[model samples]
Target: MTNTIIEFKNVTKQYDNDSPVLDHVSFEIERGKFYTLLGPSGCGKTTILRLIAGFTEASVGDIYFDGKKMNDVPANKRQVNTVFQDYALFPHLNVFENVAFGLRIKKLKESVIKQKVQEALTFVNLAGYENREIREMSGGQRQRVAIARAIVNEPEVILLDEPLSALDLKLRTEMQYELRELQRRLGITFIFVTHDQEEALAMSDEIFVLNRGKIQQSGTPIDIYDEPINRFVADFIGESNIVEGRMIEDYLVEFVGGRFECVDQGLNPNEAVEIVIRPEDLEITTKERGKLKVKVDSQLFRGVHYEISCYDEDQNEWLVHSTKKANVGDEIGLYFDPEAIHVMRFGESEADFDRRLEAYDHGDAHEQ
Candidate 1:
């Protein structure tokens, strides 16, 4: 059986005088995988990291690392490391000293520390920059140094707190790939916290979506994207057109725009559902060839494709991705395959939605 390296069981935390910041969050992170705590700002992603790092104590319940409870263990005592958002390098120290700082504290032999520090630097592709001053290195380089610093200590787990949030877009994207590759090479469990949906989707083996101090959903990137549990997740993760509808049967769904046949099951008849269709899932056609006619309200160029906003007879706004041209006032057809329709359960709260989605996956596997 695989080991669950990190476990949060009914964990809750709150400020001394404020409302709770984390409310009974529970999840298991497997060893040697990349897990992301993804959500909007102040949604408790960072709070979970703090709880794991022992920066903050749990208000209730328990946290565990490799079957060992982490109640009173100080941050430094835990076999864990953190790479903060700001890199947090010592301005007065060079790259070599900063990366070697952790090892020196452990009082390791100079030769072993030197070899490990060099290996960590090379793992981050900063092999020859050991002498570079922290003030002289670029943002990406400094970020890597921070990572090298953490990994050089050979911690069982590394917790990254929005470590790429400060870099330029291009650099951040590059570092995302590098960090993923490094994690795989080292075979260390990485628990990353970030608010960027694309970053989480691109890097995480599994993602935990949080909102308002609760876990909304947890799954692989494809699982979360193709089968979001609620309207909030459907809207937050990517560009999606949320169409309100009613399910008539296991294979049929009806909306104000039109009725379509789908392949999804386990839904009740005549129950209201929210249909989530990604913008890219939609195809544009002339009014004569489409299932539904919509008047284009605006079009914005997004480099490779045009993002067109439109409206149907019910005055409900819908967005379509198209390479074809349709002026602001022109009417066109929006076509989508039935497979693109994802139904959100009616009257499902965030936590309820998460549980239902997990159960659905479990049942699907059992049936298979």
Candidate 2:
């Protein structure tokens, strides 16, 4: 028996000859795992959520649930519920009525509806606020009410469409923890959509990073951050210092008039490539002890660390995160381990990229 709860087989969502919202997307979601669709606006993350929720249909390919095709399933017929970005609660109804609305529509017994609504609200820490009007609830409270309503239906899967986008930072962070815990306790699949990279990293067990109607990459947050497939995935996931480079041979790359040792292999000799070095991986030292010399152009104190900007001799910008202060206009040396270098090709497919990474991780690439 397989554990797959949901699957998209070559799904593409296009509209009226406009560019496709989703382009031949395929993925599987295991039961009880938290998955995030992460991307920028109009990149099709929300469209994916809509498709899964049955609010919209895929223009091509099939969607499956537990190996059964669900292309014809209507929104209300699917065993899934959605929490929208706007909270979508009824202003005229109090908390109890709002949460009980779904049950009432089904003509469920009042006793059963009451019991379910109570449990749902209490689980979301909204106990004893049954009579509170939607207008009276704070933004966070309204969000809780919305969630309570979704859970009241006993959904097998929940689709959260940027539900935390409206809350202030502190509340949003709190909700991240709360939502994660809720998913754990319920043991149901959660498909969340968000463009916030930090939110996706903090919450998702797996992430699908999307761009321009296509899935650029999908993996664990750590995997995406540590071994991004290309410049787009690397730059979109977080800040990086990417520079043009050339592969001199196996494990040697030349960049900025300097040759350095790296772990990557199996590329053509003298192949052009891109190098990604993370800001936090950079260590600042005296010029004499550094592998690269750069002049500090500016520095800003960012509470947790100083975000320093510098320029090398070739005028390429390098960003560094450090706790130690460096005066602007001062020349400094930057040191990074050989393993810090992540080499990328110009146009690598996800399959080839994953294969290459797996080769390196399993000691196969080293043999090349």
Candidate 3:
């Protein structure tokens, strides 16, 4: 049987004289998966984490853990631990003592505490560093120590609140891999909070993209990247060439003064919509043989590919990533497949977006 580890149902959090930090948010977390709450600062990602950790009370709605309501649960009573951003180890304590502090406070036997601390350190690959003082450890070492301390409690869920934000880029990248691997090894639920899109893309089994106190979308990395529900999601998840358009029919869309075939459906005829095409999906070709003619405006060499900017007759700018070079002021053709065009309606709720997608999928299956 599949067990649900955590759930937030219509949860809202508000402070005095300010708007709600989280407005009617709802989601679920399954056991033993890596879930990331991704958004900019003040988008309520941290608030969700705090609510789950029992550090704050929700202004409205209920929270659940393992099918039990947790609205009034205290921090220490919950079976969860947090690895804070600063790796909050005691500066004066050695690694072993630091990891065993919680157990000691609970009046556990000395021998049991020692065994658990040793096991936690070994789990974090720090078995030989028990006697080292916190001040004597590197940043990565300190992070592992924090993980060790948290796991020593044997919590079923671990909350990582941007724990890698303090590390350098190289170490941060290295730790990303390590954290994902550690989660799989432990087979425990990990709820990671981050504003970094790349980190969320790389590590999350599921991602909840938040903005302005609401969850904009939730899905796997590839699902969100390829089929953004709206403009905000498209612009937030990655680089996209989004333009205003109209859905002409089930498989036709018009943008930049041309009607093009597309793979999307379930929109009203001539309904105003936005279209997104990834930069890498566009190819450059001779103007005479291309579907759309564009003039090169600028280009930047981005190591693996050149990011070229072009303008069409309607002055709509398009960003194209390609391996070949193109001269500025030259007219070129932008080629893309019908399946590459993703159509999104304005102000569509997630429920509506999902229903439309279901309709399109059912229609396609019927045809096939």
Candidate 4:
């Protein structure tokens, strides 16, 4: 049976008579899955989390938790907890008291509260740090304390608002894995909010790409990365080479740079479109034998691979993820299999990217 723990039905949020922050947003979050609200900084991803936590009310529409309406409910009355980006741990409380703060409010017995707090700490891998002060712990440890505090109450849902944003890259990556594992083990719904596409893609069981206060696309990481609904999602989620193109037919497209066959089909004949190619999807070679020829503009050596930039005859710049070395001004043949091409229709506004992506489906979508 499908267990949808949270539902947003035509939810919208507006601060004033101006444009709404969340506009008619609707989706279902299944229980025991890790979902991410991903987008740029002002995209209203955090607003969704806040609304779910009852921190704010929807300007329109309704929010449901376990089939119960939450319109009049307050944050404290909801069976949910939030872990903020700042950790929000008390300066005076030690690790034990911090984790046990919620239980203490209920006036629970000393023995029971101690046991629950110890279990929560142990669950978060802070096993013998009951006496450790909050300031003494590392950033990651402190973040874990935040998690422990939230989970100690055993809330029906845990909402994390960029919990790892303040940590270093290495720590952030580590926490991504840990967060996924913890969510799976706990078998609870985890609604996370982040602007980092890599972080969202790495950890989410399902990802909702939000932009301009609305959901642009929602799917697994593989789906969102491999098949972005529109240009905004393609551009936001990762590095993509975008270009203008026209759909020639079901299996073919023509563009300024070149003509190629793609997996995506277009709804309109001769539709003005955009195509996206991931850096890794492109193959670069010094040999002069490929469909598209390019001049290497620059190369960056990352630890695992080199990110090389190239420009084709149309003066359109593209990026390729390669291990091969090449210098600026080096003419090279960039090879890509037919399957790499993706097509998108030209959008009038930024939100059009999301609207287009939401309309996009697999089985050969194209970006020119």
Candidate 5:
């Protein structure tokens, strides 16, 4: 049996006279997994988080938690806790009292609050900092305190609203690992909201890519990165080399003034499509032996690899990540495998795109 912890059924959020913030969005979140709502500003990712946290109500759909309707449930009544972006710590209180505030509000015994606060602090690796004031703590430490406060409440779901956005790059990366490990240890559902693609990809068990008040795609990080449903998803999830193309036939496509073999099929003859190839997949080689000849337009060292940009005869730019550096304006050959090409049809709905891709994938599996 699948343990679905949260379900959003055609949820929409609209205010007086304004357009819907979330337009008929529907998705299911399973228990004990890290999920991320990822998108740029005004994309409604935060709106979905607010709805789930009971901070805001959905305008046009039902929300369910553990098989119970939550449309009218109060925020305090819901079994969810939130860690806001700013950490929301109390400057006047010490760490212990800040963490104990919720328990104190619940009128728990003083001894019980003390024990739970201690345990929570220890859980977040802040056992000895209970006496420290919030102002004395570092950004990462205060963030942990916010988490400790949430976990001390024993909520079934934890919502993180871009909590690491304020930290330095190194600390943010460290917290990413810490957050993932903490979720696993606690064995509860964690809904993380972030606009950072790398953070989402690193921390989420699954990711929902949102845009224009709708989810463009949802899947495991690998699945979303490798098989984006459309041009927006392809461009948003990671660095992609997208180009206009035409599907010549099953397992074949034409792009960059040349025909190439791909794994996509079931499209109408001569249908216009877009092709995606990751920069890491393109190889640099001699022009005479390469599949495509291009001149190095620019190059930059990206610490781990050289980000080389090349332009083919038709002026279509191809971005490649390679270990070898190339001189500017030099002609170079690029090689790519047939399987690297992914054809996306123009104007296909997300459902239709997913269905067609799944069908063709199953057919390929059967043949093998």
Candidate 6:
């Protein structure tokens, strides 16, 4: 059976005399999935997390948990726990006491609190460190402690607000794997907030990309990365070579003073559009054997591949990642298959974008 753990309906949050921090945001989170609210700072990622955790009430609209309205639910009454960026463990308390804090507040039996705390600590792989003070733990260890404390309460959902942002790169990467594994083993919903695209793409079952208090897109990582809805999404998710173009027909597009075949449809004839081609999708070859000819402006060795920058006759810059080496000022040809091209409309909402994609897919299926 499908289970939706959280739902937001036209949620808007505002402060006095200020613009709304979250503007009519609406989405749903299914049970036992890892979801990432991804965006830059002040993009409402944290705001959504706060709303879910009941840290703050939405200024307008309904919030629901498990088919129940939660607009007036207090943080303590909600079936969710939060792990903050700072860890938030009591400095004076040992790991055991910290993990047992919530259980103790409920006046649970000491035996019950002890068992729950031990289980939570073991789940986080901190089994033997229960007696250690919070100050004695490393950053990653303390993070695990915070997670342990939250899990001990046995909440149905865990909200993490940039919890790994304070760790060093190596530790952060390690914890990312550990956290994902923990969530899988626990079989509870996890809602993580972050501005780091790599973190979101690497860990999330689904990602909601936000900007300016609005969600630009929400899909699996591969979907958002490979088929961004607009220039903002394309640029923010990863490196993309975007250029203005016109849709000549269902399968034809025009750009860089040349007409090319693409694999997109459902656009008005001669409609202005933008084309996105990832750097890794382009292949470098001899001018006569290539689809687009350009002069190489520069190249950078990026370990896996060389990032080559080239400009066409129309002075449109194209970035390509290729294993082949090319010198500056060298005239080279770039080749790409029709399927590598992604066409995007300007200011298209996610709903409209999905409809267009559905139509395109339907058309393809009918032809077959």
For model 5, state the Cα shift of residue 163 in Å.
0.2
Tens digit of lDDT per residue, candidate 5, span 1-368?
56999999989999888989998888899999999999999999999989998898888999999999999999999999999999999999999999999999999999999999999999999999989999999999999999999999999999999999999999999999999999999999999999999999999999999898987777889878887877888999889999898988899899988999888787778999999999999999999888899999999999999999999999989999999999998999999998788887787776875565445333442211
User: Candidate 2 on 231-254: residue-level lDDT in tens?
Assistant: 888999989999999989989999
Clashes of 1: 0
Each model's lDDT: 0.88, 0.90, 0.90, 0.87, 0.91, 0.90
lDDT by residue for model 6 (226-263), tens: 88877888999989999999999999999888899998
Per-candidate TM-score against the hidden true structure = 0.95, 0.94, 0.93, 0.94, 0.94, 0.93
Give the clashing pairs for model 5.
none
lDDT of 3 by residue, 1-368 (tens): 54888988889999986999998877889999999999999999999999999999999999999889999999999999999999889999999999999999999999999999999999889999989999999999999999999999999999999999999999999999999999999999999999999999999998999998988777789878888867878999989999999999999999988899998887789998999999999999998777789999999999999999999998989999999899899999999999899988866677875565445333432221
- Residue pairs in candidate 2 whose N, alpha carbon or C atoms collide under 3 angstroms: none
Per candidate, the number of residue pairs that clash is 0, 0, 0, 14, 0, 0
* Candidate 2 stretches greater than 4 Å from native: 347-368
**TM-score: which candidate is best?**
1
- Kindly report which residue stretches of model 3 are placed more than 4 angstroms away from their true locations once superposed: 347-368
Tens digit of lDDT per residue, candidate 4, span 1-368?
44878889989999989789998988888888999999888899999999998888999999998888988898899999999999899989999999999999989999999999999988889999999999999999999999999999999899999999999999989999999999998999999999888898889999999888888777889888987777788999899999988888887888765688788764478878888889998888655666678888988999899999888889999898988888999888887877888777775575655455444433233442
Least accurate 10 contiguous residues by lDDT in model 2: 359-368
Superposed model 1: Cα runs more than 4 Å off: 349-368
- Stretches of candidate 5 exceeding 4 Å from the true structure: 348-368
lDDT of 4 at 197: 82
